[model samples]
Target: MAPPNLPFRLIRPAPDPVLAEAVLRLLETPEPASEALAELAMRDAPFTLALLSMRPLQPGEATTLKRALTERIDEAGDALLRAWLMHTGSQQLQADAVGQLNMRAGQVAETAMHLAIELRYPRPDEAYLAGLWHHVGALSLLASTRDFPVLRDQPATALERRQAERQRFGIDQIQLAAWLAESCGLPPTLRDALALAGAHEEHVAGAHPLARILRAAIHIAGPDATLDEAARLTGLDTERLSNLKTDVDYLSTEGLKSLGIGAPGAAEHERKPSGYPMLPSGWRAVALGGLLAGAFEGIDGKRLSLRLGNAFRLLFGKTPPLMLTVTEGQVQPLPMDTAQVAPHLITELGLQVDDDTSVVALALRTQASTSHFPGGDGPGRSTRDWHLARWLGTAGILCVPWQIEDTPGVAVVGLDEHLDLPTEEQQLMARLVSGAARALAAERTRRRAMDQLGETLMASQREHIRRVTHEIKSPLTVIKSYLGVIGQRHPEDPTLATELNQVSQEIDRVGRLLGQLAHPESATEEPRSTSVSGVVQELQHVYGEPLFGQRNRELEIRIPGGLPPVAIPASTLKQVLLNLVRNAAEALPEGHRLTISSPGVLITDGRHSLELELADNGPGIPEPRLHHLFEAAESSKGGEHQGLGLSIVKDLLGQFGSYIFCRTHPERGTRFNLFIPLAKPA
Candidate 1:
């Protein structure tokens, strides 16, 4: 299982000046600052190119490494270094005929760091550098030997490759790389780590942690590496192995660009740091819990805001304050962040409709993020730079507009930190926004529905009372008529006279029931111009047979000639008449007569109008119950009828500036008189 030492390799008695200088630089600063490296690269393009040509960095290869160094390194410096590395290497590989070996070295470095993270190896950056430079010896040998392509193209095992290399050059790539690392003053650990690539399987397992990780990365970086194979070699599960592979692919790609490896003149290129926050394991579920808990706390809106802030804190290092412009019909914040603004601010913003250029407005329109400066600057200073700064303080403001389908309003949020993140992290923030929106939308929808239902119920109740009043009024009129007739004939009889007096008192009481249906002065809305005689005739034809024929009651309607149109809808007049006729038929017994007479009248308002009187002959209503006739749920027919009919008649007529009155005589039956206004001539 041991790797063989190649037999032939050229040994350099002296190192090249460029190589010697690079080694000297390493010796001078064992751990160079990222800033110094960036400045050095910027200062010398050739040096930067030479350094990048040292290894290849794949795109996005340095995410984990950058994250690990975020707090420890200068971000700008790190960015500059990465950008140049990508620019240089990418350019060299594209232009140079022999760039494959160099690209492979970069790939090795990227994969090594990935494995380091997966295996929890220490000093991952150092491990990465070690892996990248490990193949420098091979590259140097290939550069000198014109037909080395033949050697590289051979399908050979690690052991066979070393043997072939040694046979040709008198030394193998392993020995050459070890010598270079030591001469370059790379730490002994890195030097040893590089040597592990040539170790036997038994020796590999017992090597230093970094060396073992590098060996695994080197194995997996081969064209044929698979998840299962990587797992077996690195002791990682399939899931971890897959993750490591993905990380390696992305980090290496990015790392190459960061190091300016691929792009030759792109050393000045600025690579955007992954806007994505690096979250801890299982942080997504925790964030979801906070969102749900906050939403369930109620529609008060504060709980959800607080939970969102908590989720932000967990995803990012610190939680910034958030301001939510909650709107149903107007913009206002939850009770939490309201004090930040005053009434003048509200007026100045004029958020009732919102301005197209305001922060909230832009958020609603664009659905993208913006900031005042490179990093988020404070309020006032950048308020001119970005409108969001007007409200959000020193921290940068991030706004996302959310809406509910079929709702008239939207909620715009302004947060004090950057929300730019990778897709997964962005989804988390989206989930939070969406969850809050759904909760708010649901609440607004529910409240609106409840309001509509309440209005419908009230209207229905009012209609019910009106119908019952109309129904009872007709019978009560009959009762009063009978009492009056009895009194007229029984003046000499005290008992009969007392009963008549009591019945008269009850009829007076029933008239008072109309008071409950009284509308405030403002209730009289303008009436539409309509024909009164036509409405009456229509009602008579529709209901005359059904109601009158059953009880053997005859309905007679008499209208004077040239009746003017009325100021009421035809439907309203028809409803009122139908209720009146139905009441008359129900009150009158077999052989009783019901007559409707319309008499022309000239009102003081100089309007021509008419009064309609409906009279019916029927059994008298009881004196005790007569007083409650027009009251809601009160009925002369006991539970069989609700006393809403005449109340409805009054309500309908009032709409057109008209009204109804009732009169009756004992034994003469009941009569109802309705007055309707005539429309002025157009």
Candidate 2:
């Protein structure tokens, strides 16, 4: 409901149909340039206001509306501009009323530019802007009231027309236009020009230069003002004024032609029925419900809101309703595919739910639908609501609250000030909200179920690992006890005693490895420097007897003296060397020799590294097998061999920033090279 003192609702003026069609035709080209769009936007006051209203303003930044219009067109690009134009052009106004207003604005704009040049005004462009938008209040009145057209066409002076406007609407066009300029945060100079442009001749004569220019331009552009009267008002010679009038008339006529208004059949074409038929209420509800169901199919929790927003747009058209998510007392916009709202604007437009005078806040507190018109003369209007209206680029807002289980939110729908929301439409909106809420709840439930199943599987895997560790530890304990008994019984032989101690050390290593399997999170060890020669000597002692001596194969080591230590743990390096030597010994024939050598320090990838090679003269790996040699595969050696030796070797080398590569030829032999990084000095 509106205030009792207000005679009519205040709404944004509908865009001129001719100008809108011209812009639409421009957009029809495969790629419409933004410069052309900016020029078109500057010509129409309503289009200019719409563009400036949607642009996000920085705090304390002083940007003129005309400059901001060009910046926004360039930033928003073609797709968003087309969508906004299509949405704004959908609303129909009286064709005659729109045409009359457009022509008047054009004539005033041209006349003002000519007058500013003659008077040598400092800001001629601003003078033109003031002239073009001085009549904006009339457009608003036409949109807000039915009888404004009759009042607009009266054959009276400017003062008489203003008096009649004040008597009927309790406010004149100048005041309304001023208020709109203030709401858009236009510069105070421009606002003052708009506010005082319709003053009496005596008052405007002593006013600011822009106000005086606007008043004289309006007079010259009027139907009844004579050339002599315009010259007297501006203090110019009649001959000069007549020449300016001729130019203004020609320019205004050209402007009208460019807008497609004076062309043949343009008026008749605009007068036809422009509204599309709508479906019945029940069918609309069913259609929306079907779409909402499809939105939820195969969608996870993360994408549920995005898909729901898309469904809302598809059902409600381009000027779709906005869905805002409420969390921790703040409201935010839901994600959408298109950039309907810019990211920076979203950050600036976020609202608090605790605000007392906000209708959106009221909707959230009471859990009901609410509407507000920030441009109206109602009592409880807040500055925040005014800012929201400007940011949304709408005259009115409708807020519908929704809740999904524990989460509560609101859906903000843009509305025209004079358009009342029907009961059936409201009901359908409620159904849409309810359907979206239910989908959200279902998605939440599915996510919780999946989390629970993952936890159960992880627990089962941990328990199986524990049982396997226990079984392996039993055999390891028995082997250690038998080695202890043999060491005690073989003390008479020093060589045998030394071998027994080596076996005991290997058994302890197996025990430590078993402990790591049960507690894998504690397996990481700090890196340490190991002597390359020391690790090679230890490998020869540990595996030489069983792997090479028992197989009747020769082992050759060619480590140079004074080699730098490698940046790997001693235990880890020993384990890697043991695996490689064991593999070579098993694969080589009875008398084949395995050679382990270090070719000294070499620079690799801008780092000093030790080049270690293990070469064997055995039958080289087949080409097909060598391609996937490092991958874990079935063992050709059979019988409990998992064939994971090369894979494990690669993984261990990677953990220490080392690299390994193999070159094998069936005729020549096979060689494995390891580039181990050298340790840096402490």
Candidate 3:
């Protein structure tokens, strides 16, 4: 069947992954896949023979054949069968041939099972199924070639006939079918059978289990073949074959018993039939109680205690006694010999085992101050056993952890009902007892460093607050006294009256000392959602009392009406406008234009959530202090400011997530942008 350019091979090589994948997609169409294979078969005589050889099987057996094909494809995990079969027969894999081949396959399986069972193979059923399907390729070829006169007629010998057929054609049917299984990635057992079909010396030398199975099926299906002789070839006793045959037949038709699979999930509802020991009555309580007390402390006591009680009921078949230890920190387990540990335990107050109990080991790894435990009310001699027992009595179980704070290195928690200790816990206790010896020493090293740092910062803040307070207050007292003297002398004199008024103003100027207190919040509000145009109109009347008159200032409004609202609070917007414009008023030799605008707000220029810009014509904002303007007490060169106003503006804007920044150049008046988030609906 090779093309002119193609080299001679028993079967074509392979199909493309893309074409194979596409074939699976095509399979979903209602058109019959078997029809496709049959059509391909018609065009290729040899392939046609192989395809037809698989039909005419019983219905149940046909289903099994379909399962076998699925098994083959799954094991292959290939997406290319589509392309490979296109030249051969894609439809051969479907239902038309599925039923007959599947039934024949089951018959093969039944025969193999019988043969293997008679042989006493441990896995008789598996051996039978494997044996039955071993030479599917050869069987398919034999069936398809049967319609040919020479092939259908009796041959002097099966092997001789096969060789004769091969000589006449480039390859025989068996060879071609065998090649097909290999190309399709059939399981090893079936693949080997393709090589062994003729009972050739090299191909059938050792008679693999599958080959033996095929030999038995041949005997069962061929009346002339003797069952005893065939059974002997498979290492099976003829007497047992019939029974195995019945069982295999039943399995093929009725299915394997689910319980016999021996997997756990399959047996979940059934009690284990055998194999186990009588578990110790209180091992869980004994083990878990120590771990719980050491790890969680008093809060877990009730839950852990309940768990222990339930464990006791399970083990004893009745509820039994269990112990619990409740302490603020860890309930340690200590054996009787822990008194020798106090001196070392003073440091590192953490969970640890004590020298006494071999079963209970420390479990919690807490982060806490590990200062050496202080000596008790007074140190006095006490027997180690009595002391440890008292700890056990008080804490419920005896335990030891290095000093948690300034406490005993070990405390007793509880005794488990198991009344036995684990070897590991005993070792942990030894390590704890050893570590206690130096725990306190480490605490002393850390304690010294902390004490020195605390003393230094405390003294520094004290002196700084004191020195500054006195320096500022002295002049204030003198100013108040001078004002008082002037008032008494002037009574009604114009000169003295003017002098007194100046003193009062000086006091107010000095009172800006409040900025030194860092009260950024105390500064009045900033410009907010207040009407930009209306505010400009009312400015003169509102501030008439303090103005040298908006006189020299040229007020300009860049704001457009009906603009989207800003986030500014009305009161704060007014206050901020007053301070900025007032500062601008103070800066100019005379009045200058003030301009405000409506524009998109930009964030990220500063940390403010929203920003608005206010502009003025007075000598541009100084470059050096532009960024620092928001810092307390900052000032522009040659321009004196109380400094708190801008700082306070920054702080008040912070409340509503708004901010202001200025863009200014020598020729251009400063433009201060005020930004705020568009407010969300309440």
Q: Which residue segments of model 1 deviate by more than 4 Å?
A: 1-348, 351-357, 372-396, 403-427, 486-507, 514-682
Q: Give candidate 1's TM-score.
A: 0.28
Best by lDDT: 2
By lDDT, the better pick of 2 and 3 is 2
Q: What is the TM-score of each candidate against the true structure?
A: 0.28, 0.52, 0.28
Model 1 C-alpha lDDT per residue in residues 457-529, reported as the tens digit of each score: 9888878877887787788889889888888887899866765665475465454444346322334443577
lDDT per residue for candidate 3 within 390-436, as digits (tens), equals 33332123333444344334323333222223433433332323232
RMSD value for candidate 3: 28.3
Q: Which structure is stronger by TM-score: 1 or 2?
A: 2
Please name the candidate that would achieve the greatest TM-score relative to the true structure. Answer: 2
Ranking by TM-score: 2, 1, 3
For model 2, which pairs clash? none
| Local distance difference test scores for all models | 0.55, 0.70, 0.44
Error of 2 at 423 (Å): 8.0
Could you tally the backbone clashes for each prediction? 83, 0, 59
Model 3, backbone clash pairs (residues 3+ apart or across chains), number: 59
TM-score of 3: 0.28
